[model samples]
Target: MRPGADIQAFMGRLGYEFAQPELLIRALTHGSIATATRPDNQRLEFLGDRVLGLVMAEALFKADKAAQEGQLAPRYNTLVRGETCAAVARDIGLGDVLKLGRSEMMSGGRRKDALLADAMEAVLAAIYLDGGFSAAEQVILRLWATRLASIDDDPRDAKTALQEWAQAHGMQPPAYEQTARSGPDHAPVFHITVRLDDGSMADAKGAGTKRSIEQEAAQKLLSRLEGGQ
Candidate 1:
């Protein structure tokens, strides 16, 4: 597709057309491909993080009238976490519009969760800057509707549950080893192994961070142990 057509399609997916199209362009620019004149999305990502957090917090508070602070915290984390943002980005095909360095593009950067998540946040910031917070809030609610509807009132993350389970079973805390790393430097994949003291273990790979990959492995192990797999 032509560049203008591609951006138009992306705007349609994001549900917001930037008044300053340059903001959208900057939001999709990766650091590896940025220059002095063409800045990356890092600053936009920072602003977007705050904007998203505020939107999510407000939404959660209004949605759960009876929820206490403790009750709301986990749901907040689940909603704003990088993994969830990456999923949202994928849902809107954000990767296809991203501007990556040659090396990054060659290494499948378009499918990398970290890059997609960051870009998604930058795009949110762009929307906020282009229109205002109200615009950003509307976009977030529409894009995150399914996730918002599916949250448990007080859900524990996999890492926390895994640690509790290990302690309960008299095993030392689970150990996570970085078993493998692949892909280009700009967008690497992590393979992590989570092992119990008794030698039972699980391993999983993810396109996000090492910590996220380890959490995924732990979740898999927990599911297997709980017979939910």
Candidate 2:
């Protein structure tokens, strides 16, 4: 069966035409709206998770041939994590084509990170099933090209790095405090401050999620400490 106009538009953004249109349809169908006839994307999500993992692992291995397993593992995790997948899904406007129930729609399901990430994986699974691993690899590589190129050599996030720095200095783990929160429930902004035992502190504000704001704060603090501030 042919996809609808909206799904076709999504396919244009996704950069792959589906031979089995039903697979794409299934991939986009969320559990909240699913029925016996129209199943959800959970199983495909499972398969796609593994597919994404393998692709990222191989890419990282080839990208840094001399890197040890410990180094490559974190890079692989950075690429295949849910946050990265959701970022890619947003790039292709996957949320616009998601089939959601009324409750989920009212709750801003389209903007949710987890939902988008799962659907992205499910869609990749559909691509793999429709055109095999080579086609799926081509699509994955194209979509992730920029991220793969710019991925940091140090895979540890700012928070982890900050804690490690403190440990090496014989200090306690840095503390993060949410100093403020604003905006509506669906799109809230967070203000986070990371403080060290030595009274050094850094603050950062961001929208999307509190954890991200905290990470930004931690990064700022880490940078300051590393810069001899």
Candidate 3:
């Protein structure tokens, strides 16, 4: 069967066309909207995670021949992590085509990082199953070309980097506290503060998971410290 206009547009953004359009539909199907006959994307997500890891590992390995495992490992992690996948999904407007139940739709499922990431992986798996490894690799490489080119040597997440900085300066590990929370339960905004032992602190507000807000807060503090504030 042929895909609708929206799906075609999505494919245009993804730079891949599905031979079996049903696979793309299935990949966009979330558990909330899936029936027994029309399974969810969870299984595809599982497979896609491994496929993404392999592709990223190979890409990192080939990108820097002289780099050791220590250097490549972090870069691989940075690329295949859920946040990166979610960012890629957002770039392609994957959320706009997600098939969700009323509850999930009301709860803002499209904007949820975990949901977007899972769907992104499922889409990758669909591409793999529809075409072949080469096809999936090509899609991943194209989608992640910018990230692949500019990944940091350390590639540590902000929270980890902040803790290391504190340790290096003879201070205790940074602490995170959720100072405020508002909005509805399903879509809440969090205010987080990251404090160091030396009385340095930074606060940030984010709409999503508390962990993400903590990371933002840590990044803010890290940036300030690095700037000699």
Candidate 4:
């Protein structure tokens, strides 16, 4: 069933009053919703993509004083990547409020990565529209503060990247199991197990951000599998 009250409560929990409530509505509204209602989020998705890049670029610029093209490029790419944003958005309550089409709803569009990522970007654009640049900046920074802080630092983001790396190497890639995620939402530690395609497994503990730790864990797992340190 449609969870309008649940969505309202979710916004309440996020501590942001949606001045343009329709903006949030649009963010939560999917293509499925549009066929029955008005326009879908496609245009908003395009606009949001640009807006997200601009916001991340600005954040990167402000955060890294000595960042050059080489270092800044990866950070910028990672910050705006659909996978990363989808993970972050899912961590929030965005996944819960999706209003999907009946066909899409049955197909589980609500849990799909593409849908989740776009919703996050659309939500950012909505915030930008509602409260000018500064208001949007504040909200974006608040959400992306960790990514902003870690730009200049050379840290390992092992788990997901490692899988991608393995896949690039023509390997079937690895699987990660979240053994645990402790602490509050803002500060959480993850224990992820990396399992190779050959049925071999390696374990590692990562500190700092979840993505960072996962990468570090993957690196360690890769090294162990490859007979390194």
Which ten-residue region of model 2 has the weakest summed lDDT?
A: 206-215
Top model number, lDDT: 3
True lDDT of residue 45, candidate 1 = 100
What would the per-residue lDDT of candidate 2 be over residues 22-104, giving only the tens digit for each residue?
A: 99999999999999999999999999998888888888889898999888877888899888999999999999999999988
Tens digits of per-residue lDDT for model 4 on 21-132? 8877877788877865566777667777888788888778777778887777778887888877787687677877877887877766666678888888887777778777
Can you write out model 1's per-residue Cα lDDT over 77-153, one digit (the tens) per residue? Answer: 99999889999999999999999999889878898889998999999999999999999999999999999999997
State the lDDT at 128 in candidate 3. Answer: 99
Off by over 4 Å in 3: 169-172, 184-187
On TM-score, the candidate that comes out on top is 3
lDDT of 3 by residue, 66-98 (tens): 999999988999999999999999999999999
Candidate 4, pairs of clashing residues: 32-101, 157-215, 158-215, 158-216, 159-214, 159-215
Q: Runs in model 2 with CA error above 4 Å?
A: none
**Deviating ranges (above 4 Å) for candidate 1:** 1-3, 167-172, 180-192, 204-213, 224-229
Candidate 1: minimum summed lDDT over ten consecutive residues — where? 1-10
Question: Candidate 4 — which residues are off by over 4 angstroms?
Answer: 1-4, 151-229
**CA displacement after TM-score superposition, residue 39 of candidate 1 (Å):** 0.6
Better by TM-score, candidate 4 or 3: 3
lDDT of candidates 1 onward, in order: 0.91, 0.91, 0.94, 0.72
